[model samples]
Target: MKILIVSYYPLGFGGAEVSMKILASGLKKLGHEIIFASTGHYEGYKNYKLRNYRKIPFFFLRDNLLGNELIKIINKERIDIIHSNGYYTSLAVLKAAKKTGIKSVVHFRDYALACVKSTCLDSSNKEHERDTYRHIFVEYFPLRWIWEFYKWSYIKRSWKKIKQFDLVISNSNPVKEKLKSLGIESTYLANPVDLEERTKTSVKELRKEYKIKEFTILYAGTLEEHKGIYELLVTLKDFLIKNKVRFIIAGKGSSYFKILKYILENTIINAKMIGMKQHEEIMRLYKLSDLIVVPSIWKEPLPRTILEAMQNNKPVLATNVGGNIDLIKDEYNGYLIKNNEWEQRIKELMKNKSLREKLGRNGRKLLEEKHDLKKISKELEGMYKKILIKN
Candidate 1:
């Protein structure tokens, strides 16, 4: 089958891009052809080059302009399917699918399907509220309601168009449930991870080069309060002093100083904050690390970091919320932690080397059974067949 995978974000920006690269590679290996289109960093054919679309009125009509381009491409390439990775581009993609009379599949990855803003009274539970605070756009006194209406209408309109697609796949059960709650029916599909990616560098050499200590914990993401990075430090400060495990925090944000100051104040804690690294660098760090921590306070849709940990045979300890629940099986791959149970879980994995090794192996097994690209390709074909047979 020939497919044109669509996304709004450019390659190397986020997890969606990583998954797209993996998907394209897998599809190509199975004798399927792939074409790509996105917003940034040209990928040969089309680059939407949309900037300032997030402003008041353009955001509502951004997809319409793109729809014409999609129609031309769909006809030109003889594309059989257009698999759209979720974003605000759905209305245009769905319209093109209808016009071309081709099969359409949409991957629902996160909470962008709903929730117009972190400013929607539930800012506390928002996934990336720090982003909201950083770009504090006040609707202001008179026109606040008008801007709010447009945002609300935009999402509501997208919901109406989404049901027109042939199939919608949610990355986690929790996300599927959220879709169902919003009256958007979707099938649950685990996000794909590239199991074949490996570094030629030896772990011992990497340890010496990067000065990585034995029994290390790695956290890679924005250093924001919503991400729970500082909270992770405060939660485990005493434990860090007693244990020899090294905590390495990657990625930076507005809360960097707050996190840095706390670590500096508590000198005995064996923790350090290293700014963001490239994807390849992160994969190497994943190899040197013993444990991966994702202590997000929000209900994250499905964290790619956890998936990467599973890929590297490192166990994940994450909050018991959102898609994190779907990824981690208690006492299986890793512990699905709650606010109060972080210390206890870390202690268990710290003291027992055998237990950590057992859990890590189990995580790798889970990835092979569920998240392997070959398995995902088979599942995709199965779903496509069912859709074809029904149509």
Candidate 2:
């Protein structure tokens, strides 16, 4: 199979990009040819570059090179399928795939399929009320209502394109259900982690390098309030004063400066914000940490960080929301906490090393059975072959 993977960026910019890289690499290893198409900058694959666009009216349609370039690549490469990790250039790619008579697949890793705001929370959730109106109106506007109509129409319109595709897969059940609500059926395929490369690390070396003294916890994802970084910080601020544990917050986002400001102003000694670390660094941290905390307030479709932690033989303490419920077995592989319960969970895990180790082992066992890269890649390849055979 000759698969052309499309995404927004090349590398560890976010979860979607990382998943794309892993999938492409795995498919290539399985004797399938891989090519990449991106509007944003990428450095890791044989890529076709399309100019990144601003979220303005008809920007993708006007001055767009995506469709033509995709058509050219489809013909020249004899591409069997265009597997798109949807982003700004998705509509263009789908249109080109249709025009060229090639089968296409889109893997929805988030709520972009149903939500106009893309976070899946519109008027119901107060936390994202401003996001519902402000983001679309301010970011992509001259006429707000037109943009609003276009955004919603695009969502409905994408449903038509989705039905035309040979295969539509999602990373989690929540995402699949969201699509189903729009009358578009999808297959649920879980995300894979690089299990082979998850090496055991020396905790002493990691502690010395980071200048940490006590039991360590890790928060590895975007530093945004929606991601529950602010909530994590606030929930643990009082606990920091009482405990000698070290907390390392990794990843960068719009909220990085705000988090930094808070940490500085409050003199939170036990907490350290290391910004964004590369993949290898994150895996190493995963191995070194006592527990991984995923305090996501939003309904995360699936968190790759949790999978990574599990792969590294570490327990995850995450909110009981979204696809997290599927991954964690609660007191077996990991513990699921609700609102205002993160501090309590952390304290329990911090004090009990045996329980942490036991949970860590259980998590690793689960990762092997479910999210192993080799196993997932084989399943994905089988899906591709089935689509091709049917088509």
- Give the top-scoring candidate (lDDT): 2
* lDDT of candidate 1 over 33-96, digit per residue (tens): 7778666653433344444344537664677677777888889888888888885667778888
Q: How many clashing residue pairs, candidate 1?
A: 0
Candidate 2 per-residue C-alpha lDDT over 120-197 given as tens digits, one digit per residue, 9 for 90 to 100: 554333334223344556455466667676666666666676787788888998788777877878887778877778
Look at candidate 2 and tell me the lDDT of residue 125.
39
The most accurate candidate by TM-score is 2
User: What does the lDDT come to for candidate 1?
Assistant: 0.77
Estimate the TM-score of every prediction: 0.86, 0.91
The 10-residue segment with the lowest total lDDT in model 2: 123-132
Give the clashing pairs for model 1.
none
